[model samples]
Target: MTDPFFLCTLLWFALSIAALARLRRRDRQAIQAQIRQVGQLADETNELILFLDYSAPGFKEIDAFLLTDMPGRVTVVFHAPQWLFAAKAKRWERHCVVSADCLNASSSGMTPTRVVLDKGGKYRVFYEVPAFLKLWSRSKM
Candidate 1:
């Protein structure tokens, strides 16, 4: 008879893959939800929308919202995600920072021109990206 160990190991591997696939699908759906929400608010004009949360290190889950849907007319940058005072949030934050390069125009010396305070102690930074950079950023992204 064939060794049961081999069958058991194959079953374990299949289960692992299924679990991972489920997680990936969930994550993809979450990201799509984010994109859809902001996409509804975007217009086919020369306008920039900045998003953030109502807690410390806001812009917590949303880094940049880049939408190639409308191309130059409307571009969205979903800067990944950010931390939210929890372990999962911390991982999300790291993801945003690392993935935001597409639309994140900020440099070491740059700073926001205005700060918008939400209900909580958290805050949002509103920086006006240059007109030239908008096109360049969108095109490259």
Candidate 2:
């Protein structure tokens, strides 16, 4: 009775929404568990840590822009407060990066954080975006 194209589009739309929701839920749960283990209450005052995930093909084939996934690369970021940064240094939680080394790489979008994994200016700068929103918004001016 209905156009096949329309039905396919509808199904894709529903699937897309579900995927987004699922990603959000999974990300939130991971963050919450980390916060709990780190002994920090999830509050609005200050974010204890922020998680950002860069999904792509693979590291070797990852593009500088990170807009597409060709060979498959995923760089997950775990950002933490300055004071507590050292405490999490040894944990194999994720691709962890200090807040000092991260910045909002977008003019828009839900405050996605781009963390530089390299220690100093001497090495190649890797662009990695985090998945969660931090408590404080940077570059608001």
Candidate 3:
């Protein structure tokens, strides 16, 4: 009787571990999906800007300002829908310096920009900047 009970307990433990592993895999997949979505959005935004025949004023002489200056003073406007707020919040919580400036533009109507020093070079995670001027202008009105 005792042996049977022990076997049952061991089986339960194994099953529990399998379930936990599955959950962890699912969580990882979800995080990867979010990362990809963010990348795609950034790319689309860049394409749209380039399609507009506009350029990042002043930084023209420099090549790839986004990759170089991103770790320093850089601005990212969040346009992900409301449903993605939780994900954005998670990122903000993970990144963003304690004294980071969070500024919400009066025109954008969205939450303030979540600024942070890209210590881990993760800004590369985002490869595009949307129509900052247009968005700002529209938000102001």
Candidate 4:
């Protein structure tokens, strides 16, 4: 009968819609679970140390940049605050430029200074007298 055919088509359409909805829901939940796992790991790490090259635009391809800027390579150790533990680490590097500069200057030694960076954009600079300072001073006299 025509009624049976119409009923079958309608049922098939309803089942397809339900299946698509279930797949979407599962996908969303899987994404959320991944996010939570990353957050947990970030919390445990406390701090992240990233070696960077100041000559380059950003922290892309560590080996290539290191080879090009071998003389000017720097190590950036980022300390994520407790509050920002849940925040992703990748975003911080992109948004923060001052931190990068501090790291660059510390390693380059063009300036005899060391910088300490903390959360909320706070930093301190300390002068590091070269190890041979006393000897050099004696030689000057």
Highest lDDT, which number? Answer: 1
lDDT rank order: 1, 2, 4, 3
**Candidate 4 residue-wise lDDT at 61:** 40
Per-residue lDDT over 99-139 for candidate 2, one digit per residue giving the tens place of the 0 to 100 score: 32343332233333443222222222223332211211232
**How much does candidate 1 score in TM-score?**
0.36
* TM-score against truth, every candidate: 0.36, 0.34, 0.34, 0.32
Supply every candidate's count of residue pairs whose N, Cα or C atoms clash at under 3 angstroms. Answer: 16, 9, 4, 0
User: Residue 66 deviation, candidate 4, in Å?
Assistant: 18
Give candidate 4 regions above 4 Å deviation. Answer: 44-92, 95-141
Q: Sort all candidates by TM-score, best to worst.
A: 1, 3, 2, 4
lDDT of 1 by residue, 1-141 (tens): 978999999999999999999976664454444334444444222233333233324332222322222233323332334443243334333222112233323323323222221223233334433333354456755
Question: In angstroms, how far off is 71's CA in candidate 4?
Answer: 30
The candidate 3 region of ten consecutive residues with least summed lDDT is: 45-54
What digit string (tens of lDDT, one per residue) describes model 4 on residues 1-141? 469989999999999999999976664454334323433433422111232233333324433322343232223333334333224234343322223222212232222222222233232232232222233234545
Cα deviation of 19 in candidate 2 (Å)? 1.6
Q: Which ten residues in a row have the lowest lDDT in candidate 2?
A: 132-141
Q: What is the lDDT of residue 30 in candidate 3?
A: 43
Q: Please provide, for model 3 over 1-141, each residue's C-alpha lDDT reduced to its tens digit, 9 standing for 90 to 100.
A: 469989999999999999999976664454344334433544422211111111333223122333332223222333334445345435444222111112221222212222112333232222223334334334545
